[model samples]
Target: MIDQDHKLGVKEANLVSRKLQLSGIQGQEAEALVAEIEQQFGVDRVAYDPDAGTLAFSYDATHCNLDLVESILSKRGAGFATNWWNRTKRSYYRYVDQNIKDNAGYEPHCCNKVPRK
Candidate 1:
């Protein structure tokens, strides 16, 4: 299990660890690095499914409605794929604005789709 004190939640911790791995940090040290982030950010919920290679996080359970998570998983493949990183490079504010505009009245559901490996 991941360290709960880390503020990054589950998904962000996983993403940070992955990025560290890509940058040459591996094994326990990588885990520690992510934990540090969690301590700083204060994650409320985190889920890492090795089978799907996905990491998910939310500030609180209520904020992470099932349908929204399912939408993110469906739209983006498991793990931090190349496309996922690429999308992050676009204007951060733009995505936030778009998400706000698009997600109005959107009700999320739990994902029942087959997990990716």
Candidate 2:
């Protein structure tokens, strides 16, 4: 018999692990993206597997949302899953992104001015 309880409390949570369809993305590129998310986006963490072409990221909803994250990746010419839900998400993010840009005193997550160790 198949078990349905195994799927409990997954997407209902704040942290969602949506994988992007980054075709032929390399390890170095993935690492660089990770660094970008951490340094510029203020993402708490990111897990990218070049072989699988998947990236799992976690951010504080209070500070920033996934739409902003997508905006950054979109700027890098990265592609995302073509699923209906993801597609809808991308669209919504686009709207939020514009508002973020238009709003005054609204800094985009973090900055790159920090000195490297």
Candidate 3:
């Protein structure tokens, strides 16, 4: 017997991220970095500034976790210009963001999604 179901389509929202400072990731080098990140499953959009050494990206929180994003940079040898303390905090945030996404099964960083009354 053939199964029948209606309304099978699902809609997912794109999540945007704040400017993430990356050291030595500006200019031509950024092209490769962006290309690699773009290939990831969660990544939807990316913006890189050559002078400021920052990258902004959009991704699906579930499939694309924070560590995953950092992993891309770390493995590529892209350093963070910030001091140790800030780096630690940023790392912590990434962990928390991943947890939030996994728990809710929603977009990453939860705050990006506007609340509905």
Off by over 4 Å in 2: 1-21, 88-117
lDDT of 1 at 83: 59
Q: Tens digit of lDDT per residue, candidate 3, span 1-115?
A: 1112211121143243545678856477788888898788756667788766677776666566667778888887886668786588677768766675666654455777788
How much lDDT does each candidate structure score? 0.38, 0.57, 0.65
Inter-residue clash pairs, candidate 2: none
Give me the displacement of residue 2 in model 2, in angstroms.
36
Q: Which whole-number lDDT from 0 to 100 does residue 59 have in model 1?
A: 39
Residue 114 of candidate 2: its Cα lDDT? 78
Badly placed stretches (over 4 Å) of model 1 are: 1-34, 60-79, 84-94, 97-117
Deviation from native of the Cα of residue 56 in model 1, angstroms = 0.5
**C-alpha lDDT (0 to 100) for residue 84 of candidate 3:** 80
Which candidate has the highest TM-score of all?
3
lDDT of 2 by residue, 41-112 (tens): 335567887766777775434355676666667767775767786678667755654454356345565576
Cα lDDT for residue 54, candidate 3: 76
Q: Over the stretch 1-117, how does candidate 1's per-residue lDDT look in tens digits?
A: 454553443343222211100222334543443443334332354445444444444432212332343334344332234455534632352354346445654777669976568
Candidate 3: the clashing residue pairs are none
- Which of the two, 1 or 3, has more lDDT? 3
